[model samples]
Target: MLWWVLGGAALLVVAVVVTGVVLFVVAAGKSDRVWGVDDVAVGECVTVSGEDEPVVRKVSCDSTDFHFAVALKADPGVCAAKNYSRLWFGEGDSSDSFGKWARDGLCLAHVYQQGRCYHLPSSKETNALADVREIDCSSPPATGAGENYEVESKVSGMPECSEEQAEYFTEKPTPTGYCLRLLE
Candidate 1:
């Protein structure tokens, strides 16, 4: 009877240890924070504009560690009032498309620096876009460096292109109806 009791206690301890380890692993896999537009404020660092929830991050106004910075936040009603120019998202070449956008509606974003040296955005998907190095618009860009847009504006509907911003517009509009417009 004494041996049996010791055996049972050892088994119980082992089970408890295994359960604890499993719980810790699961918790670690999940992010501690999830951010949304409502969670951020003006002048905060942000993934360009999109509806898709980005892969769980802690967004803050004080930090510039992220991609594009938010100068203004707009909805379907107010987005048009703030934008000066627009470039259609997904107009980028086949090399630029990460994956066929498979599912989920898309969002458009354009980067604009003060010097007007914005580059073509590689992806419309906020979570998928990689290595975006946004800089302050007040400053000038390098003599022959890459693209950087300071303020990101999520536009409404397929934007009308003009000589002022872009020479052409998106051939493929987003299923959601709105496309990202950026400086050329």
Candidate 2:
């Protein structure tokens, strides 16, 4: 009887331990799972697609496909004060519904990794964010294109970049900016 009781108790303990471990592992995996645009929260990374009706999906910050980090999820006008780029939830809609669509969108900021090179949009380009593209630092510059800029440092608010470096500002939560220099 004693042996049976001890064995039963040990088995119960082992079961509970296994259950706890399983639960922990499941939760950790979910945290890294891709989330829908509406479900994603601030500080999470996302990739934007589709020009007509831009599709946004949450992705791991460290993922190679990561494009932008969510700065704010609110009306377009609310983001005007900040330096974030806007992606309306319902773009290409009629002018009558413009206000409603503008009220539902996400404010995104580029994920400017240090030492990476990028080709920024020209002043004439209407949609700056859509034109921003990453480039290989080792490769030669593209023909007749704007100069490629390499991220030198990232800082909060407006960065005090040198004369050779240009300041790229964005608002993730508060004011944040980056110092970029021409990629030679």
Candidate 3:
């Protein structure tokens, strides 16, 4: 009888612990200021380098909010043929002639808006200022430039804003790339 009682107590404890963990995760997602479709601007343009030429595309938002949505184009019949079926936000092939990988991640594309460099999650965003807008890239990619792609998975966490915007937004709080939320 005592053995059965102990087993029940152990199970109860385990259940409570698991429940607590799940609750914490849900709370964290909510507290992270999880972004939504309303947080992004429609028809944002970004530049991507394909095998032959550089392609420009637009960004899209998801219903979940706080996700990355970018499409790319690659030259046909190239080693890095642009395909829309995989994750879109990542570093591309830009290695030194000597054979060293240049950037930590793929320089997927150049985001529009001067003085602001946007980075998707799975890339470096630590040095980026707090004012940098962090978008969620978990949504499917939006179509652009006659391609069907989606920005689904990301390797890193938090996208970064341009350095110039980091400064101006931090200093003047104008409608600069540096600023995220509007200043009162």
Once model 2 is optimally superposed onto the true structure by TM-score, how far is the C-alpha of residue 36 displaced, in angstroms? 8.0
Ranked by TM-score, the better of candidates 1 and 2 is 2
Best by lDDT: 2
TM-score of 3: 0.22
The TM-score leader among the candidates is 2
TM-score of 1: 0.35
What TM-score, over all chains together, does every model reach?
Answer: 0.35, 0.61, 0.22
What range of 10 consecutive residues in model 1 has the weakest lDDT sum? 170-179
lDDT of 3: 0.29
Candidate 3, residues 41-140, lDDT tens digits: the string is: 3223222323322222333422232222332222222212331211122234533211222222121222223222233222222211111232333432
Candidate 2 — worst ten consecutive residues by lDDT sum?
A: 91-100
Candidate 2 — number of clashing residue pairs? 1
Writing each residue's lDDT as its tens digit, candidate 1 over 48-91 gives 43343233243443443443334444432232344311111232
Q: State each model's CA lDDT, in order.
A: 0.38, 0.67, 0.29
Clashing pairs in 2: 157-175
Question: What's the best-to-worst order under TM-score?
Answer: 2, 1, 3
